[model samples]
Target: MLSDPSRKYRPFPQVNLPDRQWPSRTITQAPRWLSTDLRDGNQALIDPMGAEKKQRFFDLLVKVGIKEIEVGFPSAGATEFDFISGLVRTGRVPDDVMVQVLTQSRKDLIDTSFESLRGARAAIVHLYNAVSPAWRQIVFNMTMPEIKQIAIEGAKLLRDNAAAQPDTDWHFEYSPETFSTAELDFSLEVCSAVMDILKPTPDHPIIFNLPATVEAAMPNIYADQIEYFGRNIPNRDSVIISLHTHNDRGTGVAATELGLLAGADRVEGCLFGNGERTGNVDLVTVALNMYTQGLSPGLDFSDIDEVIKTVEYCNQLPVHPRHPYAGELVFTAFSGSHQDAIKKGFAAQAQRNDELWQVPYLPIDPADLGQSYEAVIRVNSQSGKGGVAWVLEQDHGLKLPKKMQANFSSTVQELSDSTGRELTSTDIWESFEKRYHLKGDGRFRLIDFQESQSPKQQDERIFAGKIRIDGVEQSVSGRGNGLISSLANALESALGGQLDIIDYSEHAIGHGTDARAAAYVECRVGDGPVLFGVGISRDVATASVRAILSAANGA
Candidate 1:
């Protein structure tokens, strides 16, 4: 047994929101989405995105319906400042879009940020400062009043800078950077002081962005904090609340959703949650979540593959295959039960004409994101008959019967087990052709065939064929109730063996005059082991005769 490290680490205290209203709340619509891919996501990449890459990413964000984007932190470096200036000078920012630039709560940084936005049509100047007790005591060694004053001074500078830029429209935003780890009442107090300095009204409301900068607590606790702040913050009618959550606790998406229910009006994050440390909240996941619930998320990810390609190219990071909605295998089924359920679910869906998606093991239709059915049902050693039949039907247009599916699945399983690897549709089709389609030459080969009905009894039939048995050519004929039974008799007589046809089936392999008929035969010889065979020909009767001979040889 091991003792807990209580002395070294303490649990984060929960928010004291006894009357929290988030539990009864539900998200009925999409929030205003702001992407931070260029600023936060670009900074976290080992190789930061270049100017050209940033422009490409900006275009992709616009295509995906992101109206607000944090383009860069201009005061950080020349490259960042130039990137911001380039977008402004190039006329890359759309008229409906508002590009935002971030800065620290310092005079030099704020002034530099304004300088970068000098030629832009309009922009949001986001100012932030650390207000947590830990940051104040450990990093700055400042008292509560000192930290609050830093925010107020930054607000005054933003107001003065906007007053100076009369030709351009300016929107102001402020963040208590690590709001999740700060005292709730004190954080509200600092934000109120900034509001007093800015004096924002409903007509031109300022955005008060609360960030889960560290994510030191549970998602519900963060939600509780957001709800409390929304209820108690001064000038509530004159402010817009936004959330910026990080994923250090692996629950940033959950926190953001709950924060929306807690009455936040906007969200700020990056694609695939790419950011510093454990990264930011994944905006793609949040938006698509709303899409699945019948609420338009106001974003277009209908072609998610294109989004992944662009993001990976710009960030030089491979999206994990297990990432929700945008991954390579998000809609794939590998387990036996999962494959079976998916197969039956598709079948049931085909019989209906409704638009409601009810497939098992899939919350949303893969086709909605531009994925194909071939990628959904895959085959491996652990796969079942349903998976094998699904592959055959999708790839080769062969809808195998239930018993044939089980029989063929065993063959596939044996091959997969021997090689210890997954099998492709081509591999399964090849195996089937090799094992069953012995039409030309075998122990018993059918060269030609003919059929006739009795004059007195129309149901009575006769089959005749020219075949070779053990390299000897012979002619044989037999009478039975149907064509397949008559063919079985002819094959048995020609080969001098007792052929008992156990089962048989036939279907057209293609369409129109170019189509060929395929026939499957299962038979046993003198109580020996049962074997299966396949045949194809332009004539259905001829294909049946060939199938009988192949099964006789196989037995």
Candidate 2:
């Protein structure tokens, strides 16, 4: 039974047709999901998922509607085994849910792995051994016939182990490790022999998971392989055909979907494709693919934020900010054209859901992943009139004049690319006031000023400020309700401009009493007398000086 190490022998050599494109027509329905984040993900960790984190993640997996979760390789170590024990003991596992444990076909490992499922409602004992010719020669150091013998022996051991745990309904799953690269006939023979000895019933059907351990070829080759096995494998009607693929070639999801079309009934993966080397296929991406087509993912991952957070924390890996569905800025639009298109797309979609079908602006709604519409538009260098005006209307309740919107759009873009960051709503105000209203030369400026308040004076809150304008220095005076307004009025007289303070506020500069006070004002424009300018400063006199100059220049 020695496998052909040459790998040159062809199994139905002619593949005849080219591989189908992604977003395949054959990939219509979602398959049964099996999350191996705990088992497969754990093994890949430099600091493996500890007992507490593993147990918590286990509960989260089940609660998220993953009916069949590969808990861990119980036989690998005591921590995984103990973690499994705690999972079963808590009685938190749903009746319909199945706790799956992985082990090699070796007798000692199989026995130890089964010990973790003493009282499970129903469970799968997953066992495997290397089956490819290269694995036989290099890794296992066994001949093909020796691999067959081991496969048979492993099946018997798994059968015996399940029989001992008959009190809890048990099922079995066997994988021909790296079956994608193995000789077709050899894989079928071993899997057939194992199934015959195991005899999986309809109530507890066995699963034959063929893993493309390394993505050596395109998805179409994998599809042809699945189609061949599904068509030729004996009693496959009583067994489930499953797929476990990696992302080494960046087609793990593609391979998985086509494998299903070729007759795979289940998929095994991690949440965000976390695994060794390239990583396992991402279940979230595949599941949401189904959602986009209006099909149920079967698992309740509607609140994907919580799931992303939990996985990010458990793996101690940060989710990439641009990662689809779970990224911080996946739906954010910084380009003005993009924002305009997205906004219009949303408006059209709002009137009717079907109208926005296939809008070029967005492939998925941000809200679907619990992101807000606000995140959909960000003001920056590439931002446009629609995006900037949108921010103004939303944040400041100020409607941008049509001409003003046009003028500010270019300036906003310039400021954004210059800053190289997301511009806040406040930045928009500063941009407008600086470019237009505050373009005046600083011939006159506030030097120093301080004021003391006596609450006993009804409308006589005393205000004092100093000004040095056009080589002339002056001390000004005014009577107003507050320090900020009094400072503005006195400075307007010294500079000879009409002062109308629309809004006034102060902010603490630092932690303690020595912290300087900053002030801001919306003052009436003096030249055109048709607009307003915003002024800000740490010193009240400086604020008034700038506000008057801003209005004079703007006027």
Candidate 3:
């Protein structure tokens, strides 16, 4: 039913190298991370961040342990210039962190950028120029030689500017802006020319950032381009390969990951993947991906909720609820089967006491990022018995037996189906109390009771109580092994019905002196169907007795 567009577009050519090495490579360590939230992410906003918000975001980046950050494009305007100048003047730029400023390949913009960075302890002067065939032919209407010369002249200007600022330590970075779509040989030529002008050594390395400016091709193509450049570019030992991927294709994270495998040494991205168009690759996801692999990403996302709040406040945009790791419902499971498996996984984890996280359906432990188990299993029409039991056990400390769980699950599912919505933990508990725990006027109700153990029959216990049936009070007595059994015997004799206990479970439901015990009982009367009931009281014995009466009333 879909229109084919094969005639309109050609497939992107694969790398010519038959022995591609990136496919077998793995990321074993953390790369140098550079956050461009203030520059790239801010620029993408409809209402760009103000000075206060920019400052707050910058501090958050530092707190997240990023040693290098592209703070702003100083030549863009007054606000950009002022934010950079303020960081320099106020000594806000930490000594250990390097603040980077973006600039075009123009001499004037490079000059203004240096002026904004003056008095800073250290900074990276990031210079970029468009170098793709499409850009060269359409935007500049120039040849490859002319475009290469522009980058060389920009490198010369950067050198002169850094020389002028003798008081600050300066590092250099260059990006072939449309490297993803640029010819491999041409991209290499331009980058090599800049490196030749910069004369960078191992101790004083230059960062050659390759940006997927528009993401014209698939992610694997970008990885091939990066690998080819890393393998062929001259003075490779003196250069640091970096990736700056965009999400136009919605595979920026995958592209960056593959690119990293292709020998890239650094990453340039924004938190939550904020950038122009489809946005940049999400650094949080990429870094945390490393964290889950047992590699220390060297970033602190322990309090991810705080991170989300700060980002949302500054960006004035709510993060998607399904966003990886940071979303409100990322750890939640609504499917019946998934919830059942997760419930069993948690139980297994508790007993195993193993340090490694192996919960079903959850890739990483939610607790590792400050999330709790309370929201892991949510109840809806689609949920099953395990999810209902998990909610009660985790949130309200009521561990229902297997049969009782099935009973409560049906109650929850019917409520959710009737309401056509999901149920919260509170909703589940409210439904449970109404259906099972509520005292009702029924066939029989227990009055005050007495229990005694006979010395002659050590195992037998005698129970006697006043019962009100059909508005009349009657004295009843029966003997059995336990309070619940004796009470059931007395009730069966008076009501003339067979009493059979199917299942039972009990647990403490609160804390301290105010704590109460909750008991669940499943029973059948004569040939009647099975019924479930619950009771709560200060004493476990009383709670069990109440559960029997509740079940009888329901029957």
For residues 199-236, could you state the per-residue lDDT of candidate 1 as single tens digits? 99999888999999998889999899999999999879
Any runs in candidate 1 off by more than 4 Å, and if so which? 376-555
Candidate 3: the clashing residue pairs are none
lDDT per prediction? 0.84, 0.73, 0.85
Question: Clashes in candidate 3: how many?
Answer: 0
Which of the two, 2 or 3, has more lDDT?
A: 3
Task: Give the lDDT ranking, best first.
Answer: 3, 1, 2
TM-scores of the models, in the order given: 0.68, 0.66, 0.68
TM-score, candidate number 1: 0.68
- TM-score for model 2? 0.66
TM-score of predicted model 3? Answer: 0.68
Clashing pairs in 2: 1-144, 1-145, 2-144, 2-145, 3-144, 336-384, 527-555, 528-555
Error of 3 at 401 (Å): 34
lDDT of model 2, residue 194: 90
TM-score ranking, high to low: 3, 1, 2
Over the stretch 1-555, how does candidate 2's per-residue lDDT look in tens digits? 448755764442534335533225456676888999999987887668777568667877987789899989887778888888888988867887888998887899988988888888888889898889889988879988899888889999988887777788888899999998888789998989898898877666889999998888888788888878777788767889889999888999899888887878999999889998889988988887777778778877766666765665456565566666766677777899988887887777778846445544557666776666585322221235655665555444444444446666788879968987556557877887566544444454556666667568876566665666665678776667766556656666554675675554444445455544433344563553443333455554565446544544444
